[model samples]
Target: MQAVKNRNSSINSIVESVFDKDAANFWLQKFNPLWSFNQALGKIINKDQTAVDTVSLTIQTNKKFKLGEAGQHHPVIVTVNGRCFERTYSLTQLDVDHVLLTVKRVDQGIVSNWLIEKAQLGDVIEFGQPYGDMLLPQPSSPLLLLAAGSGITPMYSLIKAALKSNVSTPIQLMYWMKHEADAAFKAELEMLAEKHANLKVQLFHTQSEHPDSRLNESYLNQVSNLENTTVYACGPSGFVSTAEQVFKSAQSFKSEAFSLSHLASDDVGFINVTLTKSHKTVAIPKGQSILVGLEQQNIQPTHGCRMGICNKCACNKAQGSTKNLVNGATNTEPGHLLKICVNSAQSDLTIDL
Candidate 1:
């Protein structure tokens, strides 16, 4: 609501009338990101630790917030040590008023560990718009949804959305994990499978006693309609890499690896970078993200979900070229929009940073 947006100014006017203008904006922006425009926000009503180092957060989302697409992720912002850190979490719509976010704590994951170990009830978290192309294929195109480890989160969303929509698209989900006991949403998936005739689930145990039952030719041979299926896969990079090779013959394929590999820069030297807004120049080291390089010189650009999913770190390239660290894509166009967290300076660069 425009009135809600104006609420800050109204309160600021009241505070400024009594106190000072600087105090109003300072304390407002410090307490809440909503003091600014185009910011997302949510409140955690409940959180469930479903597994070891894994959490499912049920957020009471703002009424003004636009919901995310099935299988897409949104930014989750939290405050620690007075500094806000943002990370992306895949969204699963639970009801009209609430959405679920399942997060897995990664090694040295600052935000993830905070959510797991420190967050409490009634904590309000800021967020950004949801993004990612991990969605259901067309109804005419059959689906093979492959997931591993914590990658099952988005697959869970995709499967549930399709089933509820009652489309005739046949879906086969093959979820693999280290062990059956370690899988998330196992019972829920089974129940969904039983309720929907079009949904079929195949669970594989990678750490089984007999053998390493990872996805392979044998698994591919057992799945139906491989030739007709459009594939969606998510997992660890190694597992996703393996699934990509096995499903090479599918009609079409798309996948999201949980982590991106660090690539060596071809140019073994620093590139001159000009922060357009700051009007500052610095040498961005090769293979270092524009985000990190900026942080080195105390140029803190706005960012969220540094993994390149939330697009909060997106900045326009006024000039020069950059390379994407995630997908290995390259861009050289003037005014090109790129995520600084997962892109490196490829030439003398001018950014809207």
Candidate 2:
């Protein structure tokens, strides 16, 4: 048996030395689309409309894919019209080989629209290793999950994980949506709350007949042990900011925003951005992310999780000034690392792209 194993290893080494991996994988994919040398690929097996303009897809991934923590995000890559596009989304692991990806349609969003309208069952998509920090901690504390609109997706993942782990602490979720019909996993969440005594689910609709007020201090009355609970909030930038202010008294706070709010900047008009590696210069608008500006000029940079937490979009600012959109901080230092997804050009800049 040992000699046979050694012979097989020798044969494999010879085959690897003789054939290029890309060439081998090209032929391998002809038999099975998900087969690859090392790439993580998933096939869409099921699709369901979870809410108005929201969809949930069941993806069965190849063995190369590594499952991430409950609240982590994965960089999903797909090609549309021969052009590859990558976007990050939170995934809920259903089992060892399956995950649920929920997407909400955004107006003028190219990838979201394609995933909703064009992607079909048996279609294969590429995935990057999961990246995020908002995860459940050991020796758990009470959890306060605050979500707005599509933000509920990650919270749902965290909730199921917490319950499955037998976390005894109270888990309270407050989700806000424009209308009740916009709520994804409404019945599922209610069912979970019914089954788990420690889990509490609340839905707030701002556009309903009896509208609920937006995030404010008054809502704090409903949450018990406010000062002892760890809080996780996800939503639009404005909603996250409001949550941060409202839940300042929590034991610890973590947040991720799906969209960034436009920064109010005195640096108006376009600024020239010089790409050092490409030896090209383009003018991009101030007060907007450098990533968006680059995309406007059809310059695609490798990026994931546009929320700035993934660090995949970080590049060196070789010269000039930039302002951090999240905190409104300015940096004029040369050769500083800048996350193009969250930093706006404040002046003519040269970047190591």
Candidate 3:
């Protein structure tokens, strides 16, 4: 009885120490935008060169690491060559004490270069909270998933979750890539298809020697039973545009464009924007972007894609108007069509950031 009582007291003390207010406050720094998570001194359990520009990193997390849902991304913060950078990578798999993140090295991308070249086993790093709204559909509904190149990262998580749950719903995944080398997760995808009978996949190769064509309207038409399928896409701007137009025209399709910009040829032009809320006026130079101008004034807003596609930088245009830099569409509507990333101020204006 004495031993049991002592053990209980010891456990209580440890728990109290871990969850004390001061500890909570310290741990909270992990989620701040300016700050990042503390290194837990975990070894890189696994790593894989998933594709030409993509790699996977698996890290063992300590007890303090928070659990994140599938389809969310974690902001990885690292210092490469004395330059600190933060980049979000999709979580490919989740376990009780570890996380698998698949990252693609973008051309001249600061963070990607660092992770590929500098990140190694036992290296301490920090990260921010997981974010994003993309998630798996209900188990009862069929899903149509499309991905291009590294955009396959997020879908891997969703598929893993569904397979783990033994979902009865069907999934049709179409992956588009330039070449066989650029197709990451191919072996894993094949294994998944072999394991899950309800999962179907098609590889769309734009530069293939064979007839496997790029994702287009005709290819979409070839797929049967699309009207009942919920579409989810992540890819380059052109690919997303083509996919969305085809699916939205024929069936219910929702898409998430991982690319930064999705501006059309005619959307490029200068225009004016007014922010009625702050009463601040600024001129969007002919060649300057609204985002850069706003940042010059130290006005920061929620953004993922710095280009016009993600719509995260959409500000409320209380009054006045602006024009798209890539398309000729003019935003005459005061409260509608506000994409500050690509829009330029043509006249004197105010903005609500």
Each model's lDDT comes to 0.80, 0.92, 0.69
Where's the lowest-lDDT run of ten residues in candidate 2?
Answer: 259-268
**Highest lDDT model number:** 2
Which 10 successive residues of model 1 have the least lDDT summed?
32-41
lDDT of 1: 0.80
What TM-scores do the predictions have?
A: 0.76, 0.89, 0.76
Q: lDDT per residue, candidate 1, 1-353, as tens digits? A: 89997998899778657876456545766876335333456778899977667889898876557788898887777898799887777888989878888888888988888888888877878776778887777545788999988888999998888887886678888988777677788888889889888889888887878646778878877777787889998876566767888988898988877675666446679899988788889987868788998888787888765666667789788999888766567888997787888888888998887
Off by over 4 Å in 3: 1-45, 81-83, 249-251, 266-281, 285-289, 293-314, 322-331, 336-339, 342-349
Clashes of each: 0, 0, 18
Model 1: colliding residue pairs = none
Worst 10 residues of 3 by lDDT: 33-42
Candidate 1 has a TM-score of 0.76
